[model samples]
Target: MAENRSILVVGLGRFGSAVATTLDSMGQDVLAVDKDPLLVNRWSSSIPTVQADMTDVLAIEQLNAADFDTAVVAIGDSVEASVITAGNLLDAGISDIWAKSVSKEHARILQRIGARHIVNAETDAGNRIGHLVSGNYLDYIELEGEYNVVKIHTPTYLIGYTIGDAKVLERYGITVVGIKSPGHEFEYGSSNLVMHRNDELIIMGKQDQIDRFIKG
Candidate 1:
């Protein structure tokens, strides 16, 4: 099992509420905070909540924000409030801060202020959808640099061949990590494993290599 985290979540809007509730469900010790008493009250039964303006340094100090090393600033509407809240978290010595960014400018400000992670939901969703629309990948995960992991339908040319016979890694510069056939669980990839027409392969490689393999 994964170790539980203690996270402080500021703001109670849609994004903030989602993060708080998800973390709470995952058995994390989550303390949700917002300036609005109504928002605090609404979530109190589900998770611990505090009604305090996070933009105020004194309020953050009162909360003893340092007790939780990780925090998320879910305030995406107002750039000023978001920046101030994140700044306050930094001032309180919270080590890892994740913030929501409304724009490139907002993201730049958060980065400049030492926020460890910034998420722009819309931008990310758009990019993911763009990849899926190509009809090649069943799913895709982008990793650091140019690396990617993708799930794709087994190519027709390889239907009757094994991994070794196809020389997949030698020719394509990508590894077939796992394969899932119709009506069956995923199995680890091996040199002798036969490629079936209906199998879905989980491949890992650099972007250019993946693109070439997919196009071929």
Candidate 2:
């Protein structure tokens, strides 16, 4: 969140490169490390890169982990190395380590090693697939076991109505929470708006009712 905070990015694989580049673009100081010499050279100017095997205790010890505000373990293919890197960073007193996981086992191990956050591309997609088929649903996210907040594109017939006047909650058993316009993107805290032709409505209610609303 703080642009002034420095980040240590371990590994230089595709995922690692992308994450480092993204953070740098956001104005965060980054030290990108990889075992391959070529990898370090390739990204030298893109961000500060160091060539060192992260699994080696000496390599980790040689570096000043205290200088980094955060660490990201983006190692791919080898779950062992990924887990080890996360553990090493944790031991080095880097309190915030974000890890990229390959599988359920990898995710569990990363958590055990004190990774503060785990990002799994596969699991997130699988969760989205379940929501898509739940109905004509645009998207749905489970807030918890008890409730769900969903986004449904307004059908052409349902356009041109106020959120309260829509009566979607009473008629469809789903709340007409907020609307998104054709050009809208990620309006998180600002949701009180009217619906229009190309707008999207984000609603909340029981999952069963959400499915039915999307279907109708």
Candidate 3:
């Protein structure tokens, strides 16, 4: 189980609501705030929520934002509202603040206003989808720049080959970090370990190298 932490989420749009509900489900102390009374009332039974305008500095101060370990400004539609809300959270001494941004300009503004993190939700979602639909891997997570950690089904050509014989590192520049055989838990992959058809490989490398490995 994870340790519970107090979180303040401003705005109750789809993104904000998802974050609040997920955190609440994980047994975290979540305070969800929105200007809409209807939205606040709807989530109040499941998660602690209050009807308050996030842009109002006094309302933010009243919430005692400093008490929460983290704050999320999930107001993507309105640049002014998002900026003001993020500024207020910073002023209240919330050191870890994440803000949703609709554009590059919005992201820059949020960073300039002391938001510790800025999420471009649309771009991230698009990139994730692009990776998922590429048809080579089961899942992909972008690391730094062009690197990625990918989960892939063992290719047929390597079905009976050992990791070293497959030359994954030499030929593809990818490291097989772990492998999961059918009906078994993942184990650290060794160079001499033979792969099965139903096995899944957890590998990490540059995206181009991963693509080349998958293509072969």
Candidate 4:
């Protein structure tokens, strides 16, 4: 099991509330803060709550933000409030700060303010939906530069061939790094591994190569 952590979550909007509740469910010690009394009251029974204006550095200090292992700024409606709250957390010496960004500019601002991670929820969801809509992949992950990783069923044309016989890498420029037979645990993809129908593959390669491989 993973070790539990102490997390400070500032803001009580949809994103903020979700983060706090999820962390609490995962056995993390979470202190949820917000400026609105109603927002704080709504979640007080569910998690630890502190009503305070997070934009105020003194308020952050009062909450002892630095003591938490991590902090998240989820004030998405107002960029000003979000930036101020994140900056205050930084001032309090919380090294691992994650901030929600409403736009590209907002993300850049958070990065410049020293936030360790920026969550662009809307943009990320859109990208994931675009990939899913294509019907080729069960799941997709975009990596740095041109690389991508995808989980997909073994293509029909390759169903009965072994990886060595098919010349997977030489022919398609993509790698089958892992395989999951239906009802069995996942295993590493070896060159001699035979491709079976209903088996799922975890493939890694450039997007174009993966696309072409899927088409075949």
All candidates' TM-scores?
0.60, 0.57, 0.60, 0.60
lDDT of 3 by residue, 1-216 (tens): 123567888888877887677666545677999998999998899889999997988898788888988887888778999999899888888888878899999999999888887878775443442343233567778786777898988877788999999999999999999999989988898999888887889999986787677667
Model 4 scores what on Cα lDDT? 0.82
Cα error of candidate 1 at position 105, Å: 0.5
lDDT digits (tens) for residues 67-134 of candidate 4: 88788888888999999899989988887887889999999999998998788867544344235323
Clashes of each: 0, 0, 0, 0
lDDT of 1 at 142: 78
lDDT (Cα, 0-100) at 61 in candidate 2:
87
lDDT of 1 by residue, 11-95 (tens): 8877778777766654567898999899899999998899999998889889989898588888867999999999989988886
lDDT of each: 0.81, 0.72, 0.80, 0.82
Q: Which one wins by lDDT: 1 or 4?
A: 4
lDDT (C-alpha) at residue 107 in model 3: 92
Quick one: RMSD of model 2? 12.9
Ten contiguous residues with the weakest lDDT in model 3: 126-135
Question: What lDDT would candidate 3 get against the real structure?
Answer: 0.80
What lDDT does candidate 2 reach at residue 131?
36
lDDT of 1 at 60: 86
* Ten residues in sequence with the least summed lDDT for candidate 4: 125-134
